[model samples]
Target: MISLNMLSLSLILFSISAAVFLLRRNMFIMLMALELGLNSAGMAAAHFALTNSQTEPVIWALLFFAIAAAEAAIGLALLIMISRKFSTLNSDEIKELKG
Candidate 1:
């Protein structure tokens, strides 16, 4: 059914998140990976809602979607601050204590 494909797509998205978060040294890319993981989780919840023929899961997914949006906004704000302070988006370079 459609739910099955959605679940499979969620799994693939999580895998992509893992790879991007682990392999990339850029902070923006890492933030994108985090968003991907969040989206995949939302998709999985939607899949469950569809399979169960219920509205509660769908509502919960909507709430999660809102939270994800807020998280993205906060994350982008932080990204701006970090880039301004560190002058670089590289994860390794951003770690230095510039005292």
Candidate 2:
């Protein structure tokens, strides 16, 4: 019932985030889309854990969230540095990164 709805919503969010991540060239937008994708995965995991009466999935989901947070922090820091150095948020314009 509710689990199905949660899973459906999670799938929708994941799809949207994936599309945003793939289609957008801005570093900040990509970072946000990545975060949204990770969060949606965590949400699905948590929902499944609750439906199955299991603790392990919930713990894994929490760990996923922590990892996502760290990723977001590092991503933002890199984005800031990149923007400072390149003066642009568009990933396509940063050709100096290719090596």
Candidate 3:
């Protein structure tokens, strides 16, 4: 019923995000796609937990969201640094990343 629809939507979201991640060359777009994929996974977990009358999976989903948030923050920071250094966000353009 509604659960099936939600799961379908989550699957669609994951699919779209994966496609965008694979096809896009811009670092920002890739980061956004990665975030979309992570959020879709969390959404699916929460929906599954709710349908099954379970609390643990929901908690795990929430933790997953927190991790996603932290990842986005760090990713953006790195992206900004890279953009500043190279003056571009295209992954293909930035050849050498020396530390």
**What's the lDDT for residue 78 in model 1?**
97
lDDT of 2 by residue, 29-48 (tens): 99999999998999899888
* Candidate 1 segments exceeding 4 Å error: 97-99
Q: Order the numbered candidates by lDDT, best leading.
A: 3, 2, 1
User: What is the model-wide C-alpha lDDT for candidate 2?
Assistant: 0.92
Which is the winner by lDDT between candidate 1 and candidate 3?
Answer: 3
Q: TM-scores across all candidates?
A: 0.90, 0.94, 0.93
lDDT of 1 by residue, 17-65 (tens): 9999999999899999988988898898899999999888888788878
Question: What does the lDDT read for residue 71 in candidate 2?
Answer: 99
Candidate 2 has which clashing residue pairs, if any? none
Off by over 4 Å in 3: 97-99
Q: How much lDDT does each candidate structure score?
A: 0.90, 0.92, 0.92
